[model samples]
Target: MLRRNPIDFFNLIWSDEAVQKISKNTDLITRSKIEQNQENLKPHSRLRKWSSPSKADIRRLMGIVISMGVIRLPSITDYWSSNNVLCIPFFREVISRDKFWNLHVADPLPDNVSYPSKSYKIQWLLDHVNMRSQELYEMGQNIAVDETMVKFKGRIGFRQYNPKKPTKWGMKLFTLADSNTSYMWQQNLYVGADGRETELSKCAQHVLDLVEPLSNLSHTVYADRYFWTLGLAQRLIDSGFNINGTVMPNRKGFPQRLKSAKHMKPGEIIAFRKDDILMLQWKDNRVVTMITNNCRSDEWCTIKPKNPNHDTRNKPKCIADYNKHMNGVDVNDQLCTYYL
Candidate 1:
């Protein structure tokens, strides 16, 4: 994909099928908007003209969109300003600011849109990108499932707010990404209340949705405490996959001894096993409870802290592996933050 030409690279995500449909929808939306504006026009009002964008126009618009992330100013209008310091010549060369904003929509018509759906507006386009992504590359041996937010401060349903996230206010998503390259294999948008009968929490159910499709591939899927559970570990083990993740000490089925094990000093380790699943309580800054089907709780590896002041210590291999492979989504998020 890196070796592909610019046009070829664009086609991989925005295929001919997507481009054609979007072009028609863009024309329809622009026409409808212009008609509505004409109805309320005053003596000084000027109706915006409408023309269906060609395939080349669509490609150029997307290129400008990508470039906007790399180069930005205080206002959208600034990019097209006659003032030499604020103007970006490439933006005007491709399309005018008014035209770009007018053609920004590709949503389904009202009659065809599904009612009571949170993701319907952009789902069709997302489906195309996801299908193309899978076709383009194979994932790595290790996978990490986690959440990331897209920065959107708008009046839209299903917007999320997580104060802990770097992007605290935006679209919340559950993503399964390759640990090595941080390539997103699949993702599901977080819609409030899926309205399905289930024993798992909404977060756990999302992990199942993203990872279930990858079963029988012998992938080691890693997650954090908020998403993993003993039930999840058992399910993945049965499906020929492995799961290793930190767990909340107070979660159900946790050993009674581990709940109050805060007294345990740092580097102390205790574990309990039921068949193939091992539940470990390891003390670091805090006593962390973990459930796993593929890690060796008994094995230990040497650890050297990055800070020169901290002393070297022995750490569980499971913790070592988890630390190494669990940040794929975070790395992806960091890259996104830079662009945003």
Candidate 2:
């Protein structure tokens, strides 16, 4: 499946079963809603009415939706505009603006009012894509797990507010992506409180589930402080996975001596070893702390400047490796926002 190039490989990723699922669900819900409206003595369409779409129609509809993302207009209604600047001729030829809304669906609506899950609306698509991702391609020896926010402002039970994110208010996802290729392998929706599990504890479980069969494979996993913890790193090391991530600035398990190491000169490095875990603190412009169980705490890499006039500087090898391997999710996030 990976051999196929460009979007020709997309069929293998999204799969036919999932596409058909959307087609069937769209027909079912649209029919039900129209029937309900009629029974209420209010007809749904005074204009072109909806007809049940087949899998092909659903696929085409999806193409239009994706194209809409790529070719941005000021408003949703602008795609069908006949104005020379605003009109996307192909969109009008394929389907009307009203028909597009009537046909769009990725998952089935609940048969009953009682919710099956917080993400039920797109749960099947999520499951299908995640399964296809892992099944289609194998991640490299090094992988990174991180959280990404899917922007959504509407009222919802699990909408998250992280002032740090570019899209500050939206649904949150725990994502595992390939460090080598930036391909997202697995993801779990953060559905807020499920039980007594705290965010720290949930991070441990998220890593376990995201990596799945990669356990005991000596795969290196990188995470940010939001998901990393000292004890969890030790546990993952015992489970046959290597851990490298930035340490959250907290008293949790960080050594106090290292905390004061911020006073060290720029580019000075220090490290501590606790059993299998190696805790390192390096001072650059400011003190940077990281915990690792994979590379040597004392290893250094000389970064030669491309311009010879600029002096080369030696940086901790561990810090360079962490920055290199931990950007899979961030890269994927950027592509989604900027490249549709």
Candidate 3:
């Protein structure tokens, strides 16, 4: 008697195990009233003659196909062209490339097998990715949230300008990155400009939701100025998160300096009152007046004179002129200090 190959015998045994597992784990077979269907089928009908593949056979074939595809298909086409004879039926039935590859070579099973939907598979993968990220972050990690844009040619629907790359047309893609490992935590696609209030809020919410699982372990969430808002700040503060960012300018009013009752002592620092006197000397002229917040004083110390005129009596001057000639003058030109 010809000795059967050990590999082939092992495959046969594995296929039997797979089929049994599927039947035992699922209600697809038990819930279906096959007896009624059998009764309905005509005696001569092809359907009445059909027999389901054994559970072991299904599992073995699935494993073989998956192993072969993964190891063999990297060079060219992902399909099993060499094993077309064995895989054609499975390729036609299995919607997932992974399932098709796995089931094609493991065992010779029927082609009518049904599997989960593509959407279901995609959601499962996404959930797995999120879970893995959470595990890593929980071990103490820093997360950074940043936005990007993805562009596609052709007018599929609404078109918008991308702020990051203004010339390109695409929707914003927000991503969370681990500061320590530089691993991407999660990414979200949005159909709007990055700077839009709606888009910014969505990005923030997405980051917050993704990191929610690892919130306790996350050290910090780094974001740009676009995410800096009073409401966003308050929300983070309420959540017991310390925010590190550039302080936004005060929009309400300028800070007030109180008047002191006593005269200024030498080397003593005093809040310069608005009524402090300053002699404004500009080219052959002198105007003495009280310094108000209207005239910025910071510029005087840093302002460079246009030209050192030996005849100090003849210089072209005005408060604005002196400020304009100075480099590094405060852009807002706010009065900085009182000159005695």
Tens digit of lDDT per residue, candidate 1, span 1-340? 3576777766777787788877878888777767767767666432344567887788777788778889988887787888978877989998877677766545746655566577776777777777788888788889999998999999888999999987889999898899999988787888789789988778888988888877799999899999877777777888888878888877777779878896898878899998898889888887777777777878888889899899898888888888889999999888877768
> Model 3 Cα RMSD, Å?
20.7
Off by over 4 Å in 1: 1-7, 42-47, 111-116, 307-311
What lDDT, from 0 to 1, does candidate 2 have?
Answer: 0.81
Cα-based RMSD of candidate 1: 2.3
Which candidate ranks first by TM-score, i.e. highest? 1
Tell me the tens digit of each residue's lDDT in model 3 across 99-125: 322222222222365533222312333
lDDT of 2 by residue, 219-247 (tens): 99998877777768877887899888888
Q: Give each prediction's root-mean-square deviation over alpha carbons.
A: 2.3, 2.5, 20.7
Which ten-residue region of model 2 has the weakest summed lDDT?
39-48
lDDT for residue 75 in candidate 2, whole number 0-100: 84
